[model samples]
Each structure stands twice: as structure tokens, then as C-alpha cells.
Target: MSPLVHSGPRAPLRWAACTCSRDPAFVVDPAVQLVFKHQGGYATLERVEDGGTSAHEKNEPRFRPYDGRVHGVLYRVTREDFEKLAKREGGYVVQELQVQTYDDSQYNALVFVSNPLFKLPQEVIPTEKYLARVREGARDNYLDPAYQAFLSGINTVPGAGLGSEYYNTPSKYMGYSFLVIAALITLAFFFQH
Candidate 1:
């Protein structure tokens, strides 16, 4: 589940908005900016064509070219947190990726991708609530005005489950405490048997 879609607690992350090529990219080990996506994981292509280039996807948009960069945020996470995030985003599979910073710096990072098995039939418009949280976050972080403007005009529905503030504010710590308590209880029950 996307953080925007979840009404539950937020996963902790230190992140910043950046760009990633929407085109095919591969992940490689090195300190330099990578021009590719990791070959072992699922592809994030918005659409695929018939054997166009990627063995990863079968169908692609007939006439459109996907060789541009799109804005995305990068999260720095620990291995444990990475696992938790993947589990939380029911459809996401985690993979290590190399991303280029605005200054041309590169870092190996963990990214969450939608499971190909569950990808939408066609690229669907992002939900209003989803767009709202992104806007709120951009504002909160004082992201580049150009990027904020880009988000402002996107189509959206009315206020969703919760407003965009859910993304701006820190999620409740109580939820984590509850999860820990529940895990202990489950373990105790199993051991007692």
C-alpha cells in the first residue's frame, strides 16, 4: 500500500524528491550514477510493447517513447525497514537501485516497485488523495517550485479517507507499540503450546 493510500501509521524514512528516468534503467554496483535499472527485479515501466526491448514486459505503448525522466522521491532505509516497507506496500517488491542526484551524485538505494503480477491493466490516473499527499509533502519539504507546480494541476478527487495532512504529520507511535506487543503475545502463545 502506498503511504498515501494507507490510513495506518507511517513507516519512518529520510527522503528527498529527485528524478529517475522513466525509460529503461538498470542497477549496478559502484559509486557512480547509474544509467540502468536493476536487472533482477520487476520493471517500473508505465507500459510495455510487444518484445520491444525489455524481456521484462510483453506489451508496450505502440507509438509512445518512454525515454524521459520522471520525478520521484528517494528513501534511505535500513535492511530491516526495507523489509517492513515492502510488507506494508502489499504490492511492492524491494530492490537495490542506483539513483542520480541533482548534483550528479549517485547512491545505492532501496526502491519499492509494484509486483508485476498485480500491475494495473493500463496506467490509471493517480487517485486524488494520492496526489494530495504528494502535494502536501512537496510543500512540507519545500520541494522545487517547478515540481510543486507539476503536481498542482494533476486531476484529483475530493478529500479521501484522510486529508493530505496525514502525510505531513508524523504517524502515531502508538501503532508501533501495539505491533510489538502483539508479536510478543503471539510468540508466547506459540511457545506455551
Candidate 2:
């Protein structure tokens, strides 16, 4: 199964390995590598066929379909980094999810599940700034062409994505600096907002 999940009429979503690394983590299987996974589990827009509703609908997370989908990327991080992600706010619980690739290969990966106990009182809409970055990452990684088209087709927030460089540094030290910015950015976004 592809680590990427296409829930409905939404941009294809994938689990990118997030790191503070200055360079890309070679993910030989999925045919792509992640640069970052900024918004771990904020909400984005998604379309549902069959009028999706859970058996205990009230007990599950409510759906808020928007004009576009929320971009959730999985940054492949070290076990240490994974632990850090597990400690993020918004009550995101990290769990192992078996992702299926096109060749029917399965890879065990960590996915963040929103806590049922700490529900956001308001709708979780992604800022334009956040979604764009995600799209750029997907494009840069050479993901599926149709998926890229879907990302391009989504209605975007003009001047909505985070404008500044998430991190600026030289490329020489990339081998050692992968985790620095990821941890910092995740903290900044999680706490500052």
C-alpha cells in the first residue's frame, strides 16, 4: 500500500518521513523522500463519497469538508524524533500504521491520530500558507502525476502559506543537520500559534 492515503475527493496524502535533516531521506520504496512534515495533523478539506458516517458517528471525529483538502505529510524521522512528535500538543497520539505500496509491499510506519478526548471546539481549517508548502514538497519529491494535478487543482489561499524559509542553511552540513530544523519548526508552530 502506498504510504499515501487518498480518502476521497481530496489531494492525495502521503506519509513522508520528517526530519530536521538538511538533506532528503532516501526512501527507495515509495519513490519519494520527505523534506518536512510541518503540519502533522491540523485539518484540511476532503471529499467523502457514500455520505460517510461512522456507526458511532457521535463518538468519532466530525467531518468538515472544505473547498480543498488539508495537506498532511509524514516526515520520516528517527525514533528519537518520533518520540518528540508523540509529545506534540493537540493530543496527537502516534501509532504504527501499515502502509501499502503499489507493488503490494507493506511498510510499517508511524501515524499521528488526533485524540478523541481533546477535540477542537472549532473547525480545523488549514491556513493557505501551510497547504502550499505541502504541495510544494509533494511536487519536489516527484510524487504521482495525477496526485500532483489534484494538488494543483485544489483551491488555495492566496498568500496563505508560511512565506519565510522554514530553515536557511548551507548544504555542506546536510548529513548532520536533518533533525535540527524539523524539531524547531514543529515546536514553533505548535507552541507559537
Candidate 3:
């Protein structure tokens, strides 16, 4: 499981430990150190909405190869679940990686790496809500304390309302104007009658 966004208690989605009926769906395996091919890194981009507006940009997280190793939780999932997860992760590619647990036990694992075809021109600061998920995952999975502090110190951009207000205010005001005009027309009709 990805420690950056999907391994913690507060993860948006839960990963089942195994296909067996007795196993719980939300299980946090022991922390592991993963050496990704090409030095995987985390990033986010401005989510371009309709009219090229970036209202939802700050919350999207992407993982690509750069210059860092990823800290993650290990889970034993069924092959079917793995396929489903791969399908769900549309923009990512699956890479077989070697991961080492704290006990120095090593195993081959499937990891999601951002598709090389889809490269962002630049990265923007992620939103607090998104970073909170990452931080929570790191803390809950018992990642290195120093790494957790680093995650906590990460700077975050404001969320949709604050970050994109300038781009959306005109359209918002326009919608309000339409509502006001409709109300006035209804009032005029009722008064005239």
C-alpha cells in the first residue's frame, strides 16, 4: 500500500488484506522500505477544470520516478484485487518492486508508478486536505518519525475556494445575478397580478 496517500487509517480508500472471508478489508501491514525503479517521487498538478480554470488542482497527487525512495505499508492482496486496483489507478503504471520490512525480510511487490506518457509541465503545492491524508497514512503505518515530521512540515496551498476564487468569482457572481433576476421577475409578475 502507498504510504504517501493510501496506507493510513484516514485513507480515502481501504485495501483488503486478503481474499479470505475472515480477513478484514482494512488492514495495515508492517512498514516496509521500497526501492522504486528510477527513484520515485511525489507531486501534484493544478487540476484544470472547464474553461481552463484550476479549481480542483491542488488536491490531486501523482507518483513518478525522480530521486527518492518511497516508504510504504505491505499488504498481501489477491490477484483479482490487484487487477482491480490497477484498473482504478488509471494514470499509473504497475511496477514489480523489491520491498524490505523492518525485520529485514524482503519480498517482491507490485507498486503503482505514474505513467511516463503523462508528464506535468510543473508541479503545484498540494492542498492541506490532501497532505493530511498523506500525513495520516505515514503516522498510522508507523513510518520513520523523521519522515513523518517531514511530511508534517510540507507546505500546502489553499483549497479550491481560496486558491481558485479569483478564477471562479466572475462565474459565481454571474450565476447569482441570474438567480436575482429570476426572483425579481417572479416578484414583478406576482405584484402585477
C-alpha root-mean-square deviation, each candidate: 12.4, 15.8, 12.3
Root-mean-square deviation of Cα positions for candidate 3 versus the true structure, in angstroms: 12.3
Query: What's the number of clashes in each of the models?
Result: 12, 24, 1
Residue 112 lDDT (model 1):
61
Between candidates 1 and 2, the one scoring higher on lDDT is: 1
Q: Rank the candidates by TM-score, best first.
A: 3, 1, 2
lDDT of candidate 1 over 1-193, digit per residue (tens): 1234333346443232212222212233222221112121112433233444432123332222223343455544466755655776654576666765554666666666555444443332345655577677666545456656755754444444533322221123445677999999999999999
Clashing pairs in 3: 47-57
Tally clashing residue pairs in candidate 1. Answer: 12
Please tell me which model should have the higher TM-score, number 2 or number 3. Answer: 3
Q: Which ten residues in a row have the lowest lDDT in candidate 1?
A: 33-42
Q: Give the whole-model CA lDDT for all candidates, comma-separated.
A: 0.44, 0.40, 0.48
Report the C-alpha displacement of residue 24, candidate 1, in angstroms: 21
Q: What is the per-residue lDDT of model 3 for residues 1-193, given as tens digits with 9 covering 90 to 100? A: 2334443565433544333221111112222222111111233222233444232232333333222234556667667766766776755677666666656667776667545443333343556776677678677667766666656655676565533322232334566899999999999999999
TM-score of candidate 1 on Cα atoms, chains taken together: 0.48
TM-scores, all models, native as reference: 0.48, 0.42, 0.51
